[model samples]
Target chain A: MTTPAMMYVHDWRAWQPGRRDTSQPRLSVAEKPAGGHVPAMLRRRLTGIGRALCDMLAELDVDADCPLLYASRHGDGERTLEMLDSLAEEAPLSPARFGLSVHNAIPGVYSIGRGNRRTQQAIAASGDEFAALLVEARGYLAQGEPAVIVAFAEQAIPARFTAHFTTPVDTAAVALRVSLTPAQDAWALTPRPLTSDDTAESRPQPSDLIDWLCGIRDELHCHRPRQAWSLVRAE
Target chain B: MTSELEQELKHLIIDTLELEDVTPEDIDPDEPLFVEGLGLDSIDALELGLALQKRYGIKLEADSDETRHHFRNLRTLAALVEERRTA
Candidate 1:
């Protein structure tokens, strides 16, 4: 049996930034606030990933000062595609879009908004993003952080790139509350090799792992093209 | 400090930029428009150029250093528009 890590799962929350208002044109500016911690002024300036991140963070009610790990397969989905379109057309890219299209823009904005100067990491690892997120959280806990908020958000793959990429139809965010509390259920992580060639078990986004942690399965295995992680839930 | 042309330019900046929570009166005519003043970035400059063309029938040269000077502030923008306005 792999030694169970001391990290405890406190609370988890998920949010869909703009599932409603389907009337809005796709791949354009996002809709108004569907409810989140972000102020109105900031909301107007947020990309889809940023909006989803702030929304789930508000729901989780974690301290702004807690170390944060933001993971995403595609950091700023729509904005990135838009930038590409501008490049093809030989038009000047929007400075605002170019500035916020970076992988860490969401968390960078969050830290600036709350004035939290703690170390915040932004991660992007193709299929093993969830495993990477948890692993980073564990590292923070080992470094003496009382708690860690692992937030993940991603937008749908742009239509032009759908032929080459795999992504969900909507934008979603999930916040996992990983703490050092000894009372709650815990999970053990171990590196394992794939005995089978089944790649279907791998999840594309971080929110999918929430179901496994929510007791949907006692043991879940995550596989990436290069790595595999075994997560065992405690009874 | 609040001339009629400056007030119009301020209104144009606010409307074109979609700057939320900011009013025309909040913009100082002499303050820098891009960096330390209204915090508008390069993208805003493009959008503002287009909006100015549509409203004042004036064309901003993409490669002209004078265009950058005219976009420095509301006062400078108004003067450029006043010098170029045909109607």
Candidate 2:
């Protein structure tokens, strides 16, 4: 079941710095993403990736019970790195930061705040997360659910890794709700696996994925370590 | 009247927990810090404990009744700091 059925894009939101698209309605998440409904206590714990995802998810007006698929290339790396640094220094680590140092911690905290009881999956599939999320979301849609929310977030990399960033929109997120029924746009996908030699070590950025979802691209090619997909606009 | 140490503890609580819009004048010395007046949770309790250890070199036994009593309110917490603080 590599290929999912024809998928429809219901709604989407993208946030980044210096993105002034006059065509769309203005949102307050231009530079700093406010964890819209997240309370102050929990909101302070959100990293840059969590901030973008939270803002986009809240703006989409998604139901609390809806399944969530959070995809990130680097998941909570800051928290992990900070703990590593603390251990290296023989210093005490803050218990709160330790609790939020997992790939799923942001969403886990989110579920607690909203009291949401739904299947939530967090993925760290390098650059292949876009395609990976599509497959997971497609499976959720196949289950007869009206829609599922798919979010891709990338935190700002350190200065040493700035040379590795391919897109200007490195610290940003794009979230979309998808279903089986036709909507403003749709995607016809032919999913295929990529060999280890071709692009296994690639950390392809999410800027292209953002463009493709915003209808800026009629067709797009995406590559992941395990799978690649030829995505064509179906509608 | 709140003691001078209690005033310091209120500021520390706000700064450490990142409690927005709360001020030293707003926190009552006798009010509970968790599940009540301030509505702080267990995580906040752990965070405040760490902050106290780092700032004043005072540590508490984990989940002990004595620890819970000392952490009951800002007034009691300040009392613990006043008695145990080494730095």
Candidate 3:
């Protein structure tokens, strides 16, 4: 089976330098905090996970009324940590933090901020975040109209939850606009079984996958069918 | 502070605000009660207003400026409740 579709990929770091690369005729969104030499508006909006989603959606050229799909590997870790810390200290949890702690709060906040009624937030802790997100996005594509997907993953883990995994990296967010319109620039999705002796315990890390995707300057093939999908990075 | 009013307000705040780790006695009266005070926001204010209106038959006027002034603190909210109760 083949899924032929047009997709635009954006990297938060590349868009930091404030030079517009109009190679793909698409808008770009990045997560750059203050003092990062990036544009002030971009820096201001992409503050936290929920804010990042909202900012990214705001930057897209898609019709404001179109549906959105937001996927995250780990959603709202800072808020989770804060809640856990409050519980440990026996202090009252901030109601705002409590509301932002939910995994779907990113999408909910974006919906509220944009006044859009159609949005879905998907959180997949499993190794195949991109694959799961693709499946979800495909459902939107099935509607025969354009849909936007904003997928982000950050690296800051709370010390209280350190025992859960092993990885140290910074944050990254990517927003892609996908439509049913067939275009010359598109990536093909193909699934294949694993022949290597790679067990579930030895899966590729999120940072590693992100790095590989970001480094692609030309046509590249991603082999991990269950966990991998290719993006034609907008130049 | 009337015991019944205090108790009812505490329960309503706890339930409406979803203060999972707090009980009625934990909320000290006369304490500053927004953000750094109680960490509540405009959304919580609307929610609490709705719950209070539904439960006590009191209506918070839709004027944003008026609602902000009325929801300044628990004391103000309590005073409004007292007024509505008497009226």
Best by TM-score: 2
Off by over 4 Å in 2: A1-5, A26-29, A160-169, A184-204, A225-235
Q: Point out the worst 10-residue segment of candidate 2 chain A by lDDT.
A: A20-29
Rank the candidate models, highest lDDT first. 2, 1, 3
Model 2 residue A189 distance off true place after TM-score fit, in angstroms: 6.0
Reference-based lDDT, residue A85, model 1:
85
Fnat by candidate, in order: 0.24, 0.53, 0.00
Expressed as tens digits, the lDDT of each residue in A20-93 for candidate 1 is: 43343311123544435665545556755576567666555445777788888877767788889889998766
Candidates, ranked, TM-score: 2, 1, 3
Residue A98, candidate 3: Cα error in Å is 0.1
Residue pairs with clashing backbones, model 3: none
Judge the docking of candidate 2 as incorrect, acceptable, medium or high: medium
lDDT of 1 at A233: 100
What local lDDT score does residue A44 receive in model 3, on the 0 to 100 scale?
Answer: 28
Model 2, range A19-116, lDDT digits (tens) per residue? 55536552334666667678776787776556666667766644677788988877765677778989999998888888888788877877776767
* C-alpha RMSD of each candidate structure in angstroms: 8.1, 6.7, 12.3
Which pairs clash inside model 1?
Answer: none
